[model samples]
Target: MTSHSFSKFWSTDLTRDSLLSLLDTPTLKSLRLVNRAFAATTSRQLFRDVYITFRSSTFTKPARMAALERIGWNIRSVTFVINHGAEMFLPPLLDPLTGEEVCFVFTPCVRTTTPTSSPTAPASGSTSTAAGERQGVYGTWEMTDLLVKQYPPLFHAAMNVSSFVAALTHMPALRHLKVSCAGQESTHRYRRSVVDYALSSLRIAIEQAPLPRLEALSLTPIHPGGIQYLCPMAGIGSLPNSCRRWTQIRRLEIHMDTFPFDKGQATDHLKLLHSYLQAFRALRDFKFRWVGDGHKGPSPLSLATEPALCELASRSQACPKTRHYLRPLKFPYLQYMVLGNAVLDASQVSDFLTEHRHSLLEFDFEQVSLRSGTWDDALAPWRTLSSAEYDAAWGEKQPAEVEVMEVPFVLGPSPEESPATSSPEQYSKRRKKKKKKRHARTTEVAVNNDLFASTAAMLLEEEPVHRGSLNFRTLREGLSNWARSKGMFWGHGHGHGHGSSHDYLHKAVQSPILV
Candidate 1:
């Protein structure tokens, strides 16, 4: 194919999807080399999702600012990593006509460096010069302050993330919003106040913002505390009246390093979960990850299956709410349910499935052990029980019971002969007679050894039968014949045979049975 044809085919068929997979660095460089059409396509892919790490200085200050200016306007999702009390500066809105507002925003960070200390100071004469050098150290800080003061609106507006979210309220296309900090654990300790403030402000913004198309909301913690505080904030009592009005959210993911496992903690966690369920009638997907010290494992609170489920049933029965509100509140819309170290017994599992079996697509039970007989039988029993509960609650008839069958094992005769009437001497005589018969057969075979002319013929006669009952002589003859066919002899020093009947029978019986 011609290069032009190849390029066109690649761009149209392959590159469109492939470009989305490119990382930030490669995508940016590719845009410069490509034409307008290619650049536009690649730019959308590059700016579709933006991730900012607060801990990394490279991504935090200058590099991140440049990236935001280049693509932040078109970004559908933004995840922040706030750390070290360093605030992120917002990029100035691009002016299509002038393009003069595009200026870099420089934010200074503290860095400590130590120069080699002189053994002898140059007396008081050099103290002033040293003091001047120290003063120069504060130059960057002053410059940052001056810039903040000069552009109060830009700096202040950016500092209050609520306003930024408010601006995004009219963005009908916006779908996902994620806020996080820098260090996974340490950030929680140092930036807890900042995160709490940001979340509180965002909550207000979300309440007031015109988000008619929002779908997913994720609160991922850069520090451990972010997750720790999120659940409480979403609890029934803790959530603001306005916050509970978000009825359009469908997916929520809360990732934290610690979750309260005690009864008090569990109560708070459940309350938070209940509040979310009550508020977001459209929620379908839920995920929460709890991280804690290895020494201190998960919480030990047991969920009350009967009372809790009974309450839900009562509410559903009494409420005459519309299908739109009811549908979201119903367990049937739950597509994915994941319980990590949560006390979910068999009854709870059955109750949950009973309530929403039709909507449940994926269910995961981690670090939770069920009762021994909980699922020992077919899963149908559990399903039936759940169905029964639903039917009873709705005043319907119960299903018929299922019959299960059990099979018994059969035993054969023992190796010992029955001695109801026979004496010991009679049994000994019977054994001797059998031995004599076997000896007679061996002597007859030796006498007729010369009947066959060829060695192969002799070997064939010596070969033992593989089926039915056989004695020691038969096994010995079989082995002898097999060795001779391979140019070997029974009396040769190369091969030695152990003569243990018990061992031979054990080996034969232990071999695999191929049907």
Candidate 2:
């Protein structure tokens, strides 16, 4: 076996497709171990796209990164599955009449940073070496400055932001990056504040690191257990004022989980998310997904049963009102968009598409519910779909909100402490500081960087969603008179999407506001 054996084998012993098929069985593992040349040849095919859980027991990250190092350059994309916790304190949920599983775990966050049109085909059964199986592949790329993640109970975080930052160094040729946030079980070592640390570190990593080839970013929300409901799972609004706009990103995808069992309070973090999204001026493709009603059972698919983070009814308190969440969002370079599991008015969706009609080529709708107007009425801006109908508005045609954060300002300039890492004394001091005259610094329009921060409350804007009208029956009808009349073009319009921030990070971070 030799380096050139792959092409030779393809022509003689195997075809490229057959060799790739060997990847799924035990035979592939044996073939790689037969000889170094065989290993190298197989590795080029095996380690193309990498997924790391960072679930290592060894204190040093060298053991964890060793496998990634072997095929560092061989890697084209990487996914870091941060194991944050999920909620457990809510009451029970009334089962849906049907037995199908319901979930708030929208899995789109795990999508690789490749185009949905032509995604990078994965090497079947690819994986890094188990830590103890062989001598470690240490620092081949020579990243001496890679900051190691601390492992003490107080310092540990499921999100493992430190490990993620360290992992970024090895992925030089990386194009797409995904941080799929989740945790199934609770641990005493975990701290709620640690979520902020992970997000802030993420922003810093992207801003400071030289990801010259990086193009896509995707984030799923975080929902953890114990009784404290994590207001909004880590999403765009979590980034503080100091975080910078990531102009390098051309694609953006966000997967959001709705409050289980109940809608919780009246807050609109989605609007804040839309506000944050405008910073990515270079974005071309966008996708948003939501999965609600995950509280139907005890599994990860259904974590809570009562209501948001927790039930206020049991605590005897009233939920407060907040402003609307969704508005027309614009992207200068957006050519395509995909939206799912959302609630919107026909006007908002039509307005957004009309706004982007010049730059956008086409947009797809899935599992979306309209609050008012018919599909035929809402999509009228484009008049008719000539081709999958390129429209100008590459944005959301929905209404949304959640997690009322106290609207935090960056505290001076030290990166906030990881929840598990911070001591009680530090937590107490920060809590006291927050209790004091914090709003004194807040202004009518707290101009942080992009948008204003409004703490003022508004009347309840609870409009009933047309559950019947949520489906895009007409959009998928392909070529039909009714569908065409309602702006359905040629092929069924589908979507794709994929964000980071720092600075306010060196400062302390704020937990999202929950009712």
Candidate 3:
């Protein structure tokens, strides 16, 4: 018996596909050198999906970007990792009298051969113009922005949104995009300035090169839960129109720190983020997540009422002329959505689902809630019992009703095209309305909350959290009963590799369940 050559077997279509699937990036790159045929095959796959980082040694940003432009045509999926590098700091300014460093600065200063000094400068340098013939200056010079924008990946992810867009311009064929920021923390002093600049420059770059082909996008910021007050104190008009450039997008995921204020009523951030969310009208899949502790983030609050969120509702912003009116976040074509650690109004969520009932298939509330209404309100569809009172329940909607209709006698091949019969062909009127059709739809919302987070937080903080609600809603026994009571199907959190029963008892906050 004759055996087939290994080369011949390896060249088979099945074998090639298996090889590509099994091999890692390095192996594939090396295999390309085996022959010209392999080279052509591997080259396309090699760059089809790429993950690039801009972190340590970010000085090579230009070279990487250039290389991206070269291989961009082959890239369809890319993840751009932005590093919140070690604190961006500058040398402390020396006291002119003492010549000893006084304070460190985050803002960069300009260099000069012979520069004028500030009488009371933003920079820490002295006002003595005669101090040096070169490089000793103090004025209202903000060099941090210029440098940060120049190499966005080296800074915080929240600080360089457009750098992602700029990189996107290179890949006209790009489809799936993920921009994540996770690195060393920066001082609080620079966050507001850098983030403000980032937010301000968002529109110009996007309008310059809208990645029309983009279908899926994920924006994640790995910053700690604290220090979410990154928004500018002044009005930074963030509107839904900012993202209209990508309305054609199908999937979107956003991970934000929290509402703008550290502890107060700040609707501007909420409105702006809402605008960002409302912009995606054509989305089919969406996720909105807030990084919080114990899944005990508070519900929405008002200027007058004390905020359960952020521990205070005292923070306020000037009522700019561009202040936004709260509206239901509409996504008519949405299919699946996940809300992780989110704070939303019941009516907003209910109306959002009701308006697009025909399109939405799956909805999840992970380590969060549906916020259907206040705990004491009898009319609520779903409610969380909390020590703090929440917004009134979303008034009940008319019970879901089924609508029936009649279809044509001959629906035809594709329903869009049916050959026009010549005068020779005829059909009976009785057959025209014989086929009846019925249509009805249901919205599924899975609320997976940490039933015990409140109890834990009570120990660490002064406030009290609602505990019994999750026991009746999210826990397996309660959830199963809730589902069966509502005439809906329910499933436990168990899986092929699920944690032990004790884990469920101990860390209920981390689990995600569906109904």
Model 2 per-residue lDDT at 499 = 8
lDDT value for model 3: 0.48
How well is each residue in 51-105 modelled by candidate 3, as lDDT tens digits?
8664433212457667767777778887766444333322244444566654423
Q: What lDDT tens digits, residue by residue, belong to model 2 across residues 86-126? A: 32112222224553432211111112221111111221233
TM-score of each: 0.46, 0.48, 0.49
Candidate 3 accuracy as TM-score: 0.49
Candidate 1 weakest ten by summed lDDT:
110-119
Superposing all C-alpha atoms, what RMSD in Å does each candidate have to the true structure? Answer: 26.0, 38.8, 31.1
lDDT of model 2 at residue 6? 53
After the best TM-score superposition of candidate 2, give how far the Cα of residue 74 lies from its true spot, in angstroms.
Answer: 1.6
Clashes of each: 3, 37, 2
List residue ranges in candidate 3 displaced over 4 A. Answer: 1-15, 55-66, 89-167, 183-190, 193-206, 222-244, 259-267, 298-324, 343-348, 370-515
For model 3, which pairs clash?
264-314, 264-315
Task: Point out where model 2 deviates above 4 Å.
Answer: 1-18, 56-59, 86-154, 157-163, 183-193, 221-245, 260-264, 294-328, 384-515
Question: How do all the candidates rank in terms of TM-score, highest first?
Answer: 3, 2, 1
Q: Cα lDDT for residue 396, model 1?
A: 60
